[model samples]
Target: MTSPTTRSRTAAACMAVLLAGLAIGAAPAALAGTEDDAGLEQTVEAGEEVVTEDAVVTDGHVDVGPRFLDDEWTMLARDDREVPSVWRDPARTVLHLGDAAVLPAPDGPDYEFLGVEPGTPLHVVPQTQTPDVVWLGWNTQDPRVVDSVEQGATLRLDGLDGPGELFVFLQEGVTGPPNVLWDSGEPLPQELWMEVNTHVHANWVFTEPGIYRLDVTTLADLADGTQAEDESTLVFAVGQDTDPAQALAAVAADTTSDTASDTADEQTADGAASSDASPAADPATEVTDAPEAGAPSSDSGGSAMLVWGAALAAVVLLLVVVGRVLRARRARDAADQATGDAS
Candidate 1:
């Protein structure tokens, strides 16, 4: 049979164990909440927009490329001529092609890929910099982009709307064939792969002078096992007489309309019998939801420290409580033994 002192001691021991268990369990729940709150704060910060202004470049160096701005993949033009280089949104910027950019197509079979006759006048943004002309190029050297991207990125030409043909090619050596990246005459939606942390210049050829609009997109696989993509329109007034304002005001061509038109034309050519077949999906029109590229998950360290601290504190309190209960039990037992001896 258990005595009154034994019953009380058992109850106290059970209560202390239960309280310790609760403390241990509550620590994880509280840590989880703290982590969630930190994530929300980061999301809010990523959504904030950076202010930008309109810019027009007729001459001087400029790099049109992708960057992670506010933790979002963004397309912007970096004006290198600025004392502290300025980034301009492509939508609000215009590249003006002046008279100095006009040049005759080089005579040689190596240049035949340009689809222009020898000595034909072409508005050429040369691969090599011409001081009087706008030296346009691309780079993936942005600090954030270089850090987040796995290896490289893909630059896609979704559509081109202009009065003449456009060709973007690289001339590696003086005698070798030019490597074509995008040619308007070939097909739509051409892809150009660019290495991370690289800067490259290419020849931008326009068969005729007019306002041109290019729907460009950059896609990349990030280091965090996620993807990033951004689409923007690039406007160019490719002639001295062309107005930069007209290029700036130009809107991207409706890709959906073009796709529908092409489908109708194909069905017409194939006859009514083929109309029963389903149309293929348009890769360019596909939309995806991508989470913002965030800073590394190092913030969890703080929460982990808090959890450890809480666990330590709970363990110390439990030890102190058990020690007091044990000491009290010993004292009561000693007093009872002495009283029995006296009786």
Candidate 2:
């Protein structure tokens, strides 16, 4: 018969082992390496692309995933020590707030002259000179902060509203946010935009067009320990009207009356016809077609699998530890009884 003392030791040992296993199991899901993991309990394993870390399905139901932007204004600071040689190297047109346009892209690289995927935010802003790249930028006032004009400034986009995702990126020369920015509270790899001067060119894409008001913030860390900060609102009039306020109202109404959903359906219904529709005679004229497909919501089975696997592994470890402890305890107890009997 096992003594109470032996039973107690065995119980304590099993509990300790089980607790240790659980601690290890929970650590990865809670800890984060990138901004995309900021809010998620996601455990990103090695070799996974950032964009693919979206909502996934576990068992026919879609599990929640990370987000690119917080629904409200999320302030991000750029601490890059290196500044570009020219703010606008191959001088492109300046964009102003209240500027609107259907972004142009030839679906290829050489973004400077060659249009890329229509995902750049800079294309729709009104600017100093007519931007060869974005038609709406021409005839629009430059919206950049005045003080930072000469010293150089790092451009960052702030705030968000409306439907669809905003994709901004640079292929060769630079790097910035390329994932879909939705209102959902998912983690962003880098919540802040890359530091850019007027010389910087990037790809900006918007899935839906209407009036979009984005707060643009510029920060330049000078040599003298002075931080130059400037901010302004950029209003985009996309699709039908040019009036920022009216455009806003139109989209708001659409959202309120469920017109955003309606518009999406209309676009889908006419996808074939719209696909065949010729490019706008004047690129400035707002063109409406099906928005490009982005990362579709998938099963979070990958993450779920990892989580469940960890849990199962932990349980297995606990059972193994418990079994080993019990066996050892029995051996010791048998030896102790044999010694007592022999004496």
TM-scores of the models, in the given order?
A: 0.59, 0.28
Q: Best candidate, TM-score-wise?
A: 1
Give the clashing pairs for model 1: none
For residue 71, give model 1's deviation from the true position in Å. 1.2
Find the number of clashing residue pairs for candidate 1. 0
Worst 10 residues of 2 by lDDT: 56-65
lDDT of residue 16 for candidate 2: 30
Residues 1-343 of candidate 2: C-alpha lDDT, one tens digit per residue: 3443544444334323212222222123324344432321322222222221111111110111111122211122211111310111010111212233343332222233322332333222211112222311100001222222344344455565544445543332112112232222233322333222221222344545554555455455544565656553333444443344464454346446766678888888799688778564676886656444663233554777889999999999999999999999999999999999999
lDDT of 1 by residue, 227-314 (tens): 8999988889999999887676554234456678999998787886576576876899966555457733445667888899999999
lDDT of 2 at 32: 30
Q: Pick the candidate with the highest lDDT.
A: 1
